[model samples]
Target: AAAVGATKQELTLSIAIVSLFSLLFLLAEPYAAMGLGLSDDVAGAWIGGTVDLTGGVVAGAAVVSARCEEVAAIIKMTQNSALGVYILLIAVLASRSGLGGKDAASPAPPAKGEGLVYGLWKKFPKFVLGYLFCSVVASSLADRERGIAVPLLGGVARWWFAIGFSGLGFSTSFRSLREQLDGPNVLVHY
Candidate 1:
């Protein structure tokens, strides 16, 4: 979002849209997959592809079956690998379009031979590598170890998410939310 020069309002809008999409996809995919006589793994993968969050994907898959959870995790992780590329593309487009502000235009364009690969490297999401590394380590563990590790890691993730959310809530001023709520179109938009 920072690379794209999105304001707080745009980030809020993005979150709202993501929430709506996650809800609709979570509710709709299972039944649709069942109607088509798809297996749980396939249905889970479908849900994984649609949902961006790992926890949400796992929850949606678990609604169908326990095995679906594992399948969904793998699929979601695979899907998430593309996020770096997605962000890089967005950054490049933002730069080209001057969406990142006037400073973006001050730099000369890369040589023709330099191409997108060079630019993409500069904007790539490094966190993805960490995710991939953890995934590899988890996969390499013994079944018993993995059984223990999964829940432990999940609990830690939930704690971190809670802390992050609390920080965000603390940082946001109620006055700003109230002002947005006061807008005549807020209700209609919601």
Candidate 2:
């Protein structure tokens, strides 16, 4: 939605809210898990599954145990697999709504026999395939010789995601971000 300029402020607010919630979850998960008498693995899975950020999930689980972090990362990857489907759904809806580049005044509902397959193909999150492939390979290797592959795969995945995030940070317009931060809307939203 933010990419297409649909409710940009709302998207920003959603991001902020999720970030805040993830931080809160990280802080609270351990005590809550202990109170509930949950095992470290279960607690980590719950944290990873619920939190919006993979880093937060990994960090949260790491605070519990290395074994927990491993479980958490895998759960996070599994959860992320659904993102492609979500994006596809969004693309279909957006195409029907004449979003992405079309004039809003004119509706561009798919023509008489136009199938959504093409639009979905165009909008699919292609990185998800790479993620899934890496996950499958990692899982296969992890089941072999003393499970040595888990840490190696996880360390690589962490750096890959970190680099991707760094790219995003580098690409972001600081001036635009400052303007957004300065607005009364930010206060009201908060």
Candidate 3:
């Protein structure tokens, strides 16, 4: 968001719109797939890829079956883990290509091989690091050694994920939302 100079509200609105179909897709896909005589794995994978939110994908898959939940969770996590790489690539390209606007608060380019690391580090999104770290810790902690703590950990993770997803709704501006003015802005997120 910083690299592109997007405000928190803009980011939230974009994400919320993109994920607006998640709930509907989740509720319909499982039964629809079964009615079509599709396999659980195929249905689960479709739901996971189609649903933008990780927590929603997992929970919705569980409603179908354990196998479906496992497949959906795997696909969703893989997609989530790809986020850091995607953002990093965008950062690198944006920095090198001068994509930002004139008002963008970009740092001065360093001399070749001088402060390059620091420059990249400055451009890097720190949230991606934290996100990846939390994912790793959560998976690592999901071992059999956790015993009774597993359910607690799962609940906490779900709660955190739900709160994170809700940032979209909470950050939305009522003015724009109520006025329904922003078809162009909405298309830009695509």
Candidate 4:
């Protein structure tokens, strides 16, 4: 009975962790996509309709570009959901399998905090890869003629946003945030 209870608890925790991470991931995708899409649209409109207002057009373009960066940051943050899920899944599985179970008399938690650092480091590669991809896409789009790049970038951005927003719909909750802030550790921070 105890084992069954423990298993059920672990499974519930696992699902919660997965759902949260997935939600974060979903939010980020749309944020990035919308930024990209808006950038493309604004740039197109300014360039096409404001031939006489060169200064205004340039200013608008610059603003749009900054929006892209903001979106990219949001997207990167959302992507961090993957790491969150991985960590939680590992923890739950390890505990449930008796690898770190109290009954198994497992040794004390590591003193070095190596696991946390290593896990973060493992995620660095993906972050770096994402940055590289963004850089390549940005450069390619910038160098090409506006007509050639706008449609493609716009489409890609739309897809990213749609997927992210859909995921967010499934995962976000004001109640979860309220509960998190009620925790002892959060109180200590205040």
Candidate 5:
């Protein structure tokens, strides 16, 4: 009934709000678990082991303390950050080209290939040098017990995760959403 009466714009806004809320809710548990340092299995165990309401709550908290053993999160975060940097650099180049539009026949592609190589080198060049920076350095200097790299990597990963999320949000707009809502006629499969 609400959808029937609402304007296209209003309906689109409603959908966006609902979708964002749903996504946040869905991610809450995993984010909490990641923050807590508990593996999913350990979190499950803690939750299942407890009986009282407080126990359940504490179990949830415990999950947050469990460190993630998965390397996928770190890799994904790095990939996302690299992608974001590439996009940002492209946007900057596009804007500069647009400003130069009056003087040029067509905008030339920025020397992004060189920039990308240089950027990658600047970002992680030490890895190729065999110098063993960061985690390796910490491990070598402080011993394995003191040099756990997860925390440091996790912090960097979270920062990139935020950048990726922010980039995604920036690309979303009400106009595109309205178009999608109005085009739902195509959604019918029958």
Candidate 6:
């Protein structure tokens, strides 16, 4: 949603974060399974929790096993289910701190002579309702079968994933990356 007008480099950096995490987790899965002797489910849960992003969690878990991928996807989706609550909390906090409802695009509802819900109505995003509704409907329709559920929701996920990477692939300039990586900031970060 926030990806409206960020520069190509900024977009690529966001993409790279997930990509790097996926690569790191994929490489570390071997050690986690062998050197650490963590089971597939446990490793999957760990990746799911740490990766945070849905695409990275799925991709990272795929290296371990199909079962791991399933577990990681479930955990990540579960985590995503709390997005509405997070948004609500953020809106309420922003409203309380007077950080929200100041923008002309989203006018603040009056507080005087109005209920608390009214005050927050201007701050809350309308799309969150759609998100929660879809989650609930999908949860109701969720099946264990790969042929059905995978194509149902997983295909949509993969499509969005592809679109994101495809944008990065097309927009990312090699020279830009080189400059970003060669700066004094790189040395400090490293």
Q: Which candidate number maximizes lDDT?
A: 3
Question: What is the C-alpha lDDT profile of model 3 across 1-190, one tens digit per residue?
Answer: 5455455555555666666667678778877877887678997898888887777898888878889889999999888879888887777776675443333344444446755465566667786887777567656774665655667767887787779767656767767653554454554554
Mark the regions of model 6 whose C-alpha exceeds 4 Å error after superposition. Answer: 1-23, 26-30, 100-126, 139-190
Instruction: Go through the candidates in order and give each one's C-alpha lDDT.
Output: 0.68, 0.67, 0.70, 0.43, 0.43, 0.65
Q: Largest TM-score belongs to which candidate?
A: 3
Residue pairs in clash, model 3: none
Write down the TM-score of every candidate: 0.61, 0.59, 0.71, 0.31, 0.28, 0.58
lDDT of 4 at 171: 62
Write one digit per residue (lDDT tens) for candidate 5, span 112-166: 5555344333333232233224436555665564546657765785687569557
The candidate 4 region of ten consecutive residues with least summed lDDT is 1-10
How do the residues 60-120 of candidate 2 rate in per-residue lDDT, one tens digit apiece? 8887788778888999987787776776677677776656524432234445566667544
Model 1 pairs whose backbones collide:
none
The runs of at least 3 residues in candidate 5 whose Cα sits more than 4 Å from the true structure, single-residue gaps closed, are 1-147, 181-190
User: Mind giving the per-residue lDDT tens digits that candidate 4 earns over 36-125?
Assistant: 565554443433232222223333334445653344434444444354455555544443443432332133222355464443333222
* lDDT (Cα, tens digit) per residue for candidate 1, span 52-127: 6677888888877887778988899877777766777776885566443224322333445766555444434465
TM-score leaderboard ranking: 3, 1, 2, 6, 4, 5
TM-score for candidate 5, residues paired by index: 0.28
Clashing pairs in 4: 30-161
Ranked by TM-score, the better of candidates 1 and 3 is 3
User: Candidate 6's residue-wise lDDT over 100-125, tens digit each?
Assistant: 33334444544667755775675566
Q: Distance from true position, residue 184, model 3, in Å?
A: 8.9
TM-score of candidate 6 on Cα atoms, chains taken together: 0.58
Candidate 4 off by > 4 Å: 1-121, 125-128, 140-147, 183-190
Clash pairs of candidate 2? none
